[model samples]
Each structure stands twice: as C-alpha cells, then as structure tokens.
Target: MTDQLPPQPTTPPPPAEPPAEPLVAPTAELAKRQLTPLAAGVLGLAIGAAVVGGAWLVTATTGPSEPATFTLKGTFALTDSVYTDPGDDSCRGSADSGYDDIAEGTSVTVYGAEGDVIATGSLGQSNSDETGTACTYKIAVPDVPSGEKFYKVEVSHRGTVQLTAEEAENGELAASLG
Candidate 1:
C-alpha cells in the first residue's frame, strides 16, 4: 500500500567546507627573518668584487698577452761563448747586432750543443729606471760543448733562437736577442 511517505525534503547537502587557509608567518616575523636592505646590498657588492678580482687574477696569471717577441736580426758570429762564472757551468756568448723582444720580467735559457743549458738569466732592465729599450742578459752558460756546439735560446714568454753560423755571422745585438 502506498502509504503517504513522510515528506522527503530534497535539500542539497551543505556545501563542502572551504580549505583552511595556510598559516602564513606574521609580517613582523617575516621582516625579522629577511636580510636588511643594507646587508643585502653589502653582500651583493662583495660577491661582485670577488668575481671581478678572480677574473683579473686568472687573466694575469694564465692568459697570454705577451708584450713582444725577440728576434736576433744581424750579422754577428758568436766568438767568446763562455760562462759568466768560469767555475759555474754557465756559458756566455757575444753577438754583434742581435734583436730580442723580451718582456720585462721574463727569464730566458740558452742551450748549447747536446742540449745543455749553457746560460740562464732574467730579462732585466738596462737602466736604473727600468724603462730602457735594450736589455743585456749576462747569461751563465754551461761549459762550452766539445765540438760544433749548436746553441739554442728559449723563453717562457716568447720565441726561441737556434744559434746558426750564417745568422750569427754579423749584425746588431738585436733588441730582441736580449
């Protein structure tokens, strides 16, 4: 029997509760936690300075911005090739007009026949002011070789010159052949 059912109220369920708001830090607390403007600025400056200095150091130490290349250009024969110190195995040779393009503070090594380091010296300045164009390298050569000693010059910053009979025959002591 279709008994009169109690009035069934078709009401939509209550709307779902909205998600709770996340608990954000209080403004005062956030302000205290963050770095101050002055502090942040200082930190940025320090970081920038460090980067610049590091780059400069790397370039200065590792980069190859050589000033010049020395060349022995002239007609001069090496006659007296002896060591600055006779006791020492260093050798020294004289050329007429040679040319060399040596940096201010580089060192050069001269090798004699059989690959013996006959002389070594720093590219020193000629004048007291350290601004002269010409540099005389008083090298200490190793004891002269036995025969037809072939000599060669090398540097950490520039070119190498293999002592030759014809080229060493005559010329100006090259500014490069320091």
Candidate 2:
C-alpha cells in the first residue's frame, strides 16, 4: 500500500474592521487643566461646605431639643440634735461636756440626679446651737435641678449630717429637718 499526501487550498483573509468609537469622550480641556495648590484647596473647601450643609439641613429638619427644667421654689432646712463626747484623762475617762458644734456658717450642699452639686447654702447660727441643743436649720435651696427628682441634703458639723429622702420631701421645715 502506497501512502500519498493531499494538497491543501489557500484562502484569502477577511477585510479589516472599522475602528469603534471611544468608550469615554476625550476632554482635552480638562486634561490640559493643571490643578494649582490654591485651586485644589478651593475645591476641597467647596466639597467640605457641601457635606456640612447637608448635615445641617438634616439636623434642622429633626426639630428642637427637649426642655430641661424643674420647678424648685421651696425652702428646705436641716436640723441635728447630735452631741459630741469629750474624751477625758480622768479616772473614768469621762470629759466635761462636748457639743456637736456644727458651725453656724457651715456650708450645705444638695446633690442632683447625676450626683452633681446642684445647690448650695449655709446653716445659719440662728437655727443651730454650739452648745449641743437640738436646733433647726433653715436653708433656701433657691432651685433644684429637674433632673434631681429627689434630693439629698448634706451638712458638715462636728460630723456630717445628711437628711433622708423622707426628711427632704417634707414640706414642714422644722420637724422634718430637725
């Protein structure tokens, strides 16, 4: 058997295609514009202004803030009847007499809801005694923060005097305070 090779025919190539339009239009003017430092800064400022303006507009549409006020026209007083023991060097170690002399001008403080010092006043000499006798302290807590739904009144004497919730809420000054 003889193996014979067959001749292949050559065909002409297809025509060249026309070039398609560019995806993006060429901006020769923009390409030529070199951003100076000053121009770049101005552009940045304009963009920043737009962002800030948008934020301001959003907040303005949200409306006003809530009111934070409390009605506190009343006066509160503090009274203590505590005595101080004077240590003695004598046989029984009992001293003469000692009084819890809460100073006449001792400062009083009222705490608010957040434990902030909301109001301050003094326990007057006319109200308390240096001789250890039970006395009434009148304090004009001009105003109490609405935040402080309740109040805790504190005074410093020979020791600290703090009024309980029951005492602070009492409208009657003398009995509740004392």
Candidate 3:
C-alpha cells in the first residue's frame, strides 16, 4: 500500500462579492436639482396670463349681440262716415274723404327713439260699428326693439303718435284719423 499523503487543513472558498452600484445618481440626489421656487412661480404666472389673454381675445373678436325685441300692438281707427265696409273684410274710403290715405292693409310702422324704423306691419281686416259710421283696424308691428325711451307709431303716413315705452308695451296706443 502507498503511503498516504500527509493530511493538509482545508478552508471554505471566500464568500461571493456583492453586486456593484449602478452609474446613475440616487433618487434623493436627483430631487435636489428640481426647479427653484421663483422659477416655478414664474411658470405658473405665464400659464395664467396665457389663459386670460386667450379669453380676452375670444371676447373681443365676437360681434355685438342683438337687442331685445317685443311686439307692439294697438288700433288704428277711422271714425268718419266716409269710410264704409261693404260686408267684406276690408273697408274703403270714398274719394276726397280727407282720410283716403287710411285703408285696410295700410302700412303701420314703429320708430325707435332715434327715428329708426324698428318694425313694420300692415293693418288687419276692418271691423265696422253697428252705425257704420266708424271703422277700426288692428295694428301689430312685430319684433320691435325694446329699451327705448319713447316710441312713435305711424299709420299709412298719418302723423306719428308718440308713446312711452310703457305705453307701447302695454298696448295702450290708439290712433285715429278722422
């Protein structure tokens, strides 16, 4: 038998080394490079100004709004024997009756405070009194602008009848051409 080699003391291999750190900076170190307070405030103000300016531009470019409007209603009466209704929807004035200009389907105009024609309509069917001595025509001018200090109504070029806003709106205007 070969002589056995002298026994030598055995030792475990060195423990494996831990992994190396990455090249990038840690999270806490990167947070320190964030924007300063003043820079952040300036950015916020710029955003706010842009928003306000955009709104202002939109409002300025828009066209003016339309005015409010209402229907003006009243009556136009011809209280003269010369105006006669022949059992028809219309009434006719005799020639040389002085009120010959006034008739059924005549133009009725509403004027604004500045003398602008705001609305125009025509006289409706005529209604005769039992005595046949008078004829009344309904006046309706639609889409008359409101907020005027006063209104003027004209019937078939007959002189205008002045009315306050309240009077015009309340249908208190009654014009007669005899």
Candidate 4:
C-alpha cells in the first residue's frame, strides 16, 4: 500500500501569447479607405433622414396642451352728485356694475346701505346692444333723497373680483364731493 502511493502529476503550461502591436497603422489605413463623393452624400442624406423621421414619429405620438381657457370677472362702484337744476340741491346715490343686463323696459332696483330701495330705474334697450370688456348704462335714479346723506358702493364678480366696499369712511368718499 505504501508503494501504491501515486506520483504528483503536473500539467504542461499554456502557450505564450504574441506581443500586441499599436493600432495606429490599422486605424490610419482604415481612414485612407474613403467613399466616393456621391456615396458620402447619399450616406449623409440617409443619416439625416433617419434622424428627422425619428423626431417626427416622436412628435406625432405626443400632443401639446389645449389652449388655455381663461376668463375674468369683476365689478366696480361709483358715486356721483346730481342736481335737479343749476341752483337745486345735490343728492347722494351710487352706481354699480353687477346686474343682470336689464333689457329695455326691464325694471331695476338698487338698495342703499340700509337695504332701502334708494333708486328705482328702468333699463333702456337703446344702449343694450354694446358688449365687451366694458359696458355702460344710462341709469336714471328717478328720485333723489331730500336731505344730506351718505352713499355706499358695492361690487362683486366671480372668485376673481368678489364684493368690495368703495367708501373710505375716513373722508375718502367726501373727497370727491366737490
């Protein structure tokens, strides 16, 4: 059994590799192999077309946002003094922009700070034909209060321009009395 012990085996080594040569010669030779002008032009056109076609496909599959739909809502108030005649006393009232466009022959009423119908006017179709960002109405507040009084203006619209008071009690309203 001792004599049967196997001798250690050794495998032959792999073959040695050849030394590497610089790639400069092969690269230069490849560069020297040039295509004809016509072939080069055709190849350039094909590359350009491929790029353009790819871009077109990408664009065609995608869509742009819909044109924005927006609107503006607002209201304003104004107070003006009016005298029956040059020598008559002036009365106080207000004009506001927030009524259903009253049609000709339509009856309209405006309330004062106390909710009293301060003005009772009729809508005239004569000026109803106009429309745009601004509108004007020939309002006739047929009767004016008989004594010295205060006036208030109120305006309202959508969320854009909600109701607001126009008077500056600290004498802002009187500043325009003259």
Candidate 5:
C-alpha cells in the first residue's frame, strides 16, 4: 500500500458583517405632530386683527393734529375820481387825501370769527382799469387759519368785509374805498 498523504488542515469561512443603520427613524420612535384646520384659521385671523388694530391706534393718536392754514387772496379797488390818470395806463393816488389807504405797502388784515387778527399782508403795486377810472391792488395774506365759521378782511382803516369760511376758501375777497 502507498503511504497515506498527511491529512490537510481545513480553513473556516470569514464571519458575516453587521447590518447598516437605517436613514429614517422607525415609526415607533417618532411622535405625531399636526394642527387642526379650524385652529390654523383662527390663528391667522387673530394675527390679522392685531395688525389692523395697531395701525388704527397709531393714526388716531398722532394726528388730525395741526389745524389747516390757507392763503387769503383778493383785490382792493379804489374808485376815487380825483386819482385817475387818463393820459397814462397807471393810476396815481396821494398820501395826503382819501386815497392814501389804497397806496402800496398798505396793511391788509384777516380776522377770525372771534375778531382776532389771524393774518396780515401788504398791498402790491397798483393796477389801473382800461378807463383809468378804477385802481386795483392785489391782496395776498398768507397763513390764514381755516375751520373758522367766518372771516373779516380789512384794508388799512377801511371797514371790514365779512366772508364765510366757504366764501373765503374760494379766494375771491374784495374791498373798496372811493
């Protein structure tokens, strides 16, 4: 008999690797989180109301504060026959006579309903009508307060002309001295 070969040693297989971790957590580990549709709508409405109420409060507190003011504009007409300049396009008045108040730089005053002076201005240069029989001076009194029931405007020492606040707002005031 042939000599028996030496018994070969057998090698065991390598051990298997452990499984990898999952990307998402298992359902048992996560808690449920959600809002009902009615609750969501009520929250949105509350936020909207807060914003609107805040805006209204700010507007009411800060103003409608400053009283309104306006310019009082009109004309002062002089019809004295003695002051007419027939040869020239302009009219002339004397400081010594009745027409003195119609001269340039005369003070124009605006009074409120309480008879207090509200504004003051001066007459501009004199302009003559086509016939030179009438002289008109422009009156521009600025910063006259509004909201008065009425106004009284005076040029120099001449009488005051009463005007409703609505009429004065039209800016068509006029005063005359002959």
Candidate 6:
C-alpha cells in the first residue's frame, strides 16, 4: 500500500503594531511645561517649611500639659443644722423634730513638692436633718503640681483620716469621718 503524508497544518501571521512615539514630548514643550530649577528649589523649600511648620503647630497644641488638680471626698460632722430665718429672726422650722442638722464648714491644707504649703481650701456646706451619718462634702483643691502624688490632706473637723490609694493614684483623695 502506498503511504500518504499527513496534511500540513495552517498557521496565522502575527498582528501588525502601531508606530512607536517618544515617551516624552518635545524638549521645548517639556521645558515650557516643567518648573525651572529656581522655581523647583523655592517650591521644595516652601513645601518643606510647610511640613515642618505644620508639625510644630500640631505638637504645640498637644504638648506641655497643664498641671493636675485633686478632689477630696469625705464626710464632715454637722455641729449645727439650724437654718437662720432670712425673713424673720425666729427658730421654729426644724426638719428633725425641733432640731436641724447640717455639715459644718471644713478646711484643708495641702503641701507642695517642696514641702511648703501650696494650697488651702474650705469645703462647702451640706444640709442635714439631724439623722443618719455625717454629711458628705466634696473638697476641691485646684492647681496641684504635676509631679506630686500625695498632698498630705489635713481636714479641720475630722483630724487625720486615710484615703484610698486608688483614689490618690487617680488624682483624687477620698475619706470618711464619723
């Protein structure tokens, strides 16, 4: 038998490509479009200055924190709770039967970092009905130094009392005096 060769396979030609152009425009056009050396230097300086100045401004606002203050929570005894009659000089309207009870005035002395007395304040008054426990007062001491943790609190009415260390750690001093 006569052997016949296999038929030849057909192949397609490659596609044509578009003409290539220069990556950049003409030098004259590029020169017109681009910044000069002096211009570039000034622009770079301005940008750098703007970045630095912006950083400085941001840090200035958030830096150098103000000093810390403290609030003391404690109870004060009410030696007298009788409200003086504003309209007429008389003592009859007493909430507790015939006696009124309110917290008396209190003062505190706070020492500074140098062991000198830095701040002193008188606590506000609290009304009482001559019953229950003593009245509670929130003693505020402002403008304490940043480095000072404890202020050596001395209450006028309660003598000496120990406040919670946690409260002192969080810039607050709290105590209860009967």
Highest TM-score among the candidates is held by which one?
A: 3
What range of 10 consecutive residues in model 1 has the weakest lDDT sum? 74-83
**Of 2 and 5, which scores higher on TM-score?**
5
For model 1, how does the per-residue alpha-carbon lDDT over 28-143 read when each residue is reduced to its tens digit?
87878978899999999999999999999998999975342233332211222212323433223323333223333456665655667755655433221122222344333233
Better of 2 and 4 by TM-score: 2
Clashing pairs in 5: none
**TM-score: the better of candidates 2 and 3:** 3
Candidate 2: residue pairs that collide: none
Clashes of each: 39, 0, 0, 0, 0, 1
Candidate 4 per-residue lDDT, tens place, 24-71, comes to: 678778898999999999999999999999999988888684442211
Global CA lDDT computed for model 4: 0.38
Q: Which segments of candidate 6 are over 4 A away from where they belong?
A: 1-45, 54-62, 66-69, 78-107, 112-114, 118-120, 129-138, 142-149, 155-164, 167-178
Poorly placed runs, candidate 3 (over 4 Å): 1-65
What is candidate 6's lDDT per residue for 1-178, written digit by digit as tens? 6598788768867778977988988888877887889999999999999999999999999998767654544434333334544453322224663333223345676665455766677655443434422344556665544456445666663444433434544645655443
**What RMSD does model 6 have?**
14.0
Instruction: Compute each candidate's TM-score over C-alphas.
Output: 0.27, 0.36, 0.62, 0.24, 0.59, 0.39
Model 2 alpha-carbon drift over 4 Å, by segment: 1-28, 45-100, 109-121, 124-138, 141-144, 157-178
Candidate 2 overall lDDT versus native: 0.51
Clash pairs, model 4 backbone: none
lDDT of each: 0.47, 0.51, 0.84, 0.38, 0.82, 0.55
- Least lDDT summed over 10 consecutive residues: which range in candidate 6? 85-94
